[model samples]
Target: MQSIAVSMNLLEFAEPVLIWLALFFFVKSGRVKRFPMMTTYLAVRAASSVILELILNLQRFASVSDTLQNSIYFYTYWAFYISAAISIFFVIREVFLHVSEPVPGIQRFGMLAFNWVAVISGIIAISAALPLKGLGAGMVSIGFQVMRCVSILELCLLAFLALFIHSLGRSFRSLAFGIALGFGLQAGMELITSLIAARSSYLDSSMNIVLQVAITIVLGGWIVYFLSPEPHAEREAITLPVSSPLIRWNEIANALGHSTPHVVVGQSSATFLQDVEKVVDKILTKNSISVNS
Candidate 1:
């Protein structure tokens, strides 16, 4: 038990360091403009970690009442958690846009679909939480469900990149792909850990440590990706063949939500009536000639 506590403490200390390092690389890579949401996520997470750690230290040493400390910690932790979750949604969106950048039409259409998915996921999450007992419990349940939904989305995004990488002419080594890969791995670990924790309380402490380790590894991977020299050639605009399915779909998506232009009459009302009379006279003449024949 002592060893496990020590390990947990070490990880808690290590996580903020790893996160700060990752943030430094992320900014150094100059991807802050490209992935602002991801930047926000990292910043929020790092700040939250520091604040939470400070609170813990205070609880250990400060003369504050236990109830007051617990309340402050509870509210602060959940607030940060909720903020992180919201930031993650935007991070996923930014990555998706980057992946689909070469195809504007698909990116536009995909965003619409993405919005619908988010709405549906929120609805489902809220519905799942409705059965919980207290308001606080329900809110917490909603947060968990929302995170689970986002995790599933992360996995889906990774799968999409994996399956369509060749068709999209994107290399697996690209930063966008790396981001997806890291998040996908973390998401998978989170989902699995949650499931196991639900099944057995005995493993909760061990699983918490494992989850922390996985998160650190993900942060490390992000740092490596930012530090690595990306191939400039891959940055060139990809030209998909006109016959390619992606292109075809892009065209179809572009065509959606657009209506053909309505015809307009440039002629004055008198001219329009004259032309109508002329057409009517011609048709009548043709009928009279046929009758005579």
Candidate 2:
């Protein structure tokens, strides 16, 4: 137990440090302008991590009554989980935009789909959370359930983007990818802790320490990733004709599991991408011309 407390203390101290360092480098990277949603999400996450640590410190060593300590603990629990859920949602949306921004039509589609995913998934997660009612249910237990739901959604978002990396011209943002990877690792750790808490009393006592170490490692990884420069964006070399059928492109995109959003237009809104072969031909021709000239 003494070792556990030491581990927790070390982890809590390191969290805000990692977060602030990552944020400093994130801003220095000039990512805020291009990824506003992700920047906002990171700010919220860093603040909440600090606040929750403060609350936990008060809960632990403050000379407060049991009632007051309990109140503080409950407040801290909900504050962390709620903020985490919201941050994950924002990161998913940010990644979607980053992955779709090269194509205007695809960006619109991804944004619309992201909105749908975030809203509908939130409702479902809340509905799942509702069943863990009663004072005896415990906030940690309930919050863990919510985290599981959020984890499933986070993984789904990552899976969607990862599977279509070849189809989409744009790549994931460095910040967005870091957040997702960190969150996924934390979620996995929590899920493991939850299972241990259910099955083994001994393991349950040390589960919080396990979670803390996992958090530290994940955040430390983020600090490193964010400080380093991201790769140059994938080139979009082939320009399609101006008069291609926008609706047909939309259909083709959907058929190819790439969404094209519906927008109001009289006869046109977005032009279509050329066929893969034609696009390759056009790019080769342009490169040949440049080389010859």
Candidate 3:
């Protein structure tokens, strides 16, 4: 069972590694500027993994009290959450950047408000982990409670972001895909945790590796494909004329099969200014005019 668990973890790591490689190539090729945010998220995830290993060693190799274990778990978990929260914010920003319509005047203001909320949440997560002396007992402290409450508010904000992005479905296909998978894994993991009534401080950290690997695969592949030089070049080369040029007017007016008025220059007498004036005079006098000139 132990060997199986390690093997499973190894297999899970492959997907994320592939994702990282894909995104890495894209970043190197200048395919995506947003790669940095996603890359940083993965780095934080790697750090979380290291922290998880240390915690496990402390439990297995060294003697640590359950309370201390729980405390360490809370700190590491909060760190993961903070990192994840920031990552989600960047993802949402990417979605907005590709919004089908220009950012609304209201959304421009909302973005500023959202940034402040993100900052406040990051600070709160750090504060929550700052137990009195880094013990679980400190979590019941006033500061931690307030921070937790704020974290809940941040959670609500994510819902709003989801709805906002949903309005831009046509343009944000890649981001929408990543969010669907990332959030789906998150929800499934949380549901499993609650249903099983089992809590492992280390469990979430390990799962994050899996989630990161999955994200790396899906988002990384998408960025590479969509941001490839060829596709970008094609997009840049597309010339959608806002106004028809003189050449277009000539083509439409003179081109065969076009419905522009065809004036028979020499054959039609109505094509001349002199002919038009003579016709008008004739109409006024109720008489005819001879074309002598």
C-alpha lDDT score of every prediction, in listed order:
0.86, 0.68, 0.51
| 162-281 per-residue lDDT for model 1 (tens digits) | 998767878888888988999999999998998899999999999999999999899989999999977885577777777778988888878888897899969666777789999999
Candidate 1 TM-score, true structure as reference: 0.81
Candidate 2 lDDT tens digits, 236-288: 33233445454456555556655668898685443455456678899999999
Q: Which portions of model 2 show Cα errors greater than 4 Å? A: 1-5, 53-64, 103-113, 125-146, 166-173, 205-207, 234-251, 254-293
lDDT for model 2, please: 0.68
Instruction: Please report, as a residue range, the 10-residue window in candidate 2 with the lowest summed lDDT.
Output: 233-242
Model 1: residue 216 alpha-carbon error in angstroms? 1.5
* Number of backbone-clashing residue pairs for each candidate, in the order shown: 0, 0, 3
Better of 1 and 2 by lDDT: 1
TM-score head-to-head 1 vs 3, winner: 1
TM-score for each of the candidates = 0.81, 0.65, 0.44
lDDT, model 1, position 260: 75
